[model samples]
Target: MERIVCLLIFIIFNVVAQDEFIFWAELSNKNFILHHQNETISMAMTKSKNKTLEYACEITYVQNDFKEKMYDDFGVIAEEKMTKLDKFNFLNIHKNDLIDCFFNSKIDVKDFVKSEQTYVQSETYVRILPLRFVVEFHDNSAFIYYLK
Candidate 1:
């Protein structure tokens, strides 16, 4: 019974550590899209009135995609998609610092990216719950990671 209890504790600790690692690893990636509950968060940066850059953690969704033919003579089309789904913004002054801190950690960023790609390529959706996130990828032929 004592051995069993120790095993359970180890499992719990490892699970918690993995969750924390995923959270930080995703944030460190430049093209990270995270969904928690019913909202999605993506990093965006803009210049403030003083011209100093300000960063935003906001929610956004893709509404539609518009494709226009660049030239009638050729088969090239320029595509553009835009959507805004910000219910609220959390302005963190040290967001970059937080991301940088992860880079300095022992977590392997390349492994994280590779693992994410494998999930994205899977036919079925992947869920990392308790955080309650659904990693739904589109276009299986090309690994595109998007969350819903």
Candidate 2:
């Protein structure tokens, strides 16, 4: 009986700790590309409840040679022409309560690029709560940011 109660408590804790919404996207995939010229990626989210929540967010760019490795390993082909990434930026919709989360997300690859000569690609996993969200990369690196 004691063990059963402990197990039930553990299950409830795990469920409460998990994010309400989780999204995954391969940034290099054409489906996620919003503007080829701008090198933008976008993902859509939906929720049944209509509630507005204010939050903050943090964007981090890690420099690495993962781009070349990603293309080689995943067979992702790069175009002959590439956009020069000058600055990294992130955008999401929070003003509209109808939108549960990010409507048209955009992420630039400038700060994330290791060098000018290397290509850039990323796989992102996003976990969203009512007041906060976390973006995690394939490398196990993550950033905790709040959204408004």
Candidate 3:
């Protein structure tokens, strides 16, 4: 009788394990899209701005021209098909990330840090973050953020 009871318990445990399922969160670039689960969170379109170590372009989804035409020496349409164009690329400057904005004319990190300006050399790739500073990338481009 004991042996029969043990076999029944083992079968029940195996069935319960088989019925269990797992869920996961989707990761793209620097964003995490989550769904409602016991161990996960649901992500929305507005949550794409969550702060993460990774970075990606937000405007990477552009469609190509769906129609194309070919011309011969006689200026006649030969073929029609889809065509693609070059993708646009831009820099993303977060509040914690370091940026080069040509804040100095000496091109020295020490000298720029000593001054009370929030500018740096655009050609240099440094990882120094300033405290509460503004960066003007172009004539009408200016942004303010904090350090890490």
Candidate 4:
């Protein structure tokens, strides 16, 4: 009976592992941050402007806090944050320079948020706007986006 139970457990573990492996392996690599998230890292990208490479990252683990407000205000919008990031520190770095910084430096979740909320959880985002400079080489189109 014990042997049978152990076999069942092993089968269950194998199935779960296979599902996880498939989920991560099948994701698109067009975006680096998303690609990393699949490897057990949590991150998100925000809007970028034309010819600019700067993107915003969400550091909080709390999802969907502003959903109702977004739908009521903008009509069925996606994730929106009540917090506004300080532009002075992050934006002082130019788009191209920022991308270089992200590649070289290790990012922390606190780097993106304005407040310290213990229960809210946290995430990190690496700005990928500088990638736009290389997009033409990859045959990519210009995309405009605004995060809610």
Candidate 5:
């Protein structure tokens, strides 16, 4: 009985592993983010409720509650973008420059809120906005975003 159970388990595990490997291994090839203009797009790939990988892309310039919202917003949107990410890809935007935008999307917020009730959750302070910056969050997760 033990041997039979072990054999079944091994077979099931192998199948599951193969599926997961295929899913992840093909990500680089099939991911929409890979083909997008890296300079203007920022993507966050995360696992979904269905145990599938999902991604959210941000243009990075719009809705960034920065110091000067009006001027920046005008310059970015007039250029006709889904979101304002003009400044995020600036070559002059050094690592020291302070800029912020939510790297994760609204769907992520909704999912978080569903999990922990007390307060609404959001993907705030994702340090990957400025694109030129690399951040090591308190959770020891290091994120380096490339825009260009």
Candidate 6:
């Protein structure tokens, strides 16, 4: 009885300590594409500044391009196919998780926290969420939640 109660408490504490945040961005032109070899995961796109776009890119898989089209002067057009991309490599930042990541990675988020701005990172891409304070990311991007 007491052991069961203790177990339940432990589970609840861990669950509350972890929070999840969702992130999203617009996929603009070719500049937004992030590719490795033949695989690609593009950005968000929208026609209206108000609504979401039709085609949002996510790295569902990665594959090697092997089929070759031999040209007299030029190189082959190698065949590309679907393969798996590691979820850990994908950069998906959630609003709440920003502070936690910074702390875990030994980064500073004091300024953003004080300013009430939501911070996100993607190596070359860093943003602050303003409109909704919360957003969603690809299912694979869901990460740890933080408190304080």
Give me the candidate number with maximum lDDT.
2
Candidates' TM-scores? 0.17, 0.24, 0.14, 0.16, 0.18, 0.16
Candidate numbers sorted by TM-score from highest down: 2, 5, 1, 4, 6, 3
- The TM-score between candidate 2 and the true structure equals 0.24
Question: Any idea what lDDT model 5 has?
Answer: 0.28
Residue 67 of model 4 has an lDDT of 31
Q: Which candidate should be chosen as best, given TM-score against the real structure?
A: 2
Screening candidate 4 with a backbone cut-off below 3 angstroms (N, C-alpha, C), the clashing residue pairs are 53-129, 53-130, 54-129, 59-123, 79-148, 80-148
lDDT of 5 by residue, 77-122 (tens): 2222212233334212422222223233221111112235664433
Candidate 2 residues lying further than 4 Å off, grouped into runs, are: 20-55, 59-143
**lDDT per residue as tens, model 1, 21-128:** 122323222235333212123332221132222221222223221223221334322111111111112112222433433233333323233346445421222322
Candidate 5 wrong stretches, greater than 4 Å: 21-49, 55-148
lDDT-superior candidate, 2 or 4:
2
Q: Candidate 4: what lDDT?
A: 0.28
Q: Which stretches of candidate 3 lie over 4 Å from their true place?
A: 19-148
What are the Cα lDDT values of the candidates?
0.27, 0.32, 0.24, 0.28, 0.28, 0.28
lDDT of predicted model 6:
0.28
Q: On residues 51-130, what C-alpha lDDT tens digit does candidate 6 reach at each position?
A: 33222223222233122321123442211221112121333322223333332222212212222257443322233221
* Candidate closer to the true structure by lDDT (higher is better), 1 or 6: 6
Off by over 4 Å in 6: 19-148
What's the number of clashes in each of the models?
0, 3, 3, 6, 3, 8
| Stretches > 4 Å off in candidate 1 | 1-23, 27-91, 111-148
For model 2 the local lDDT of residue 32 reads 43
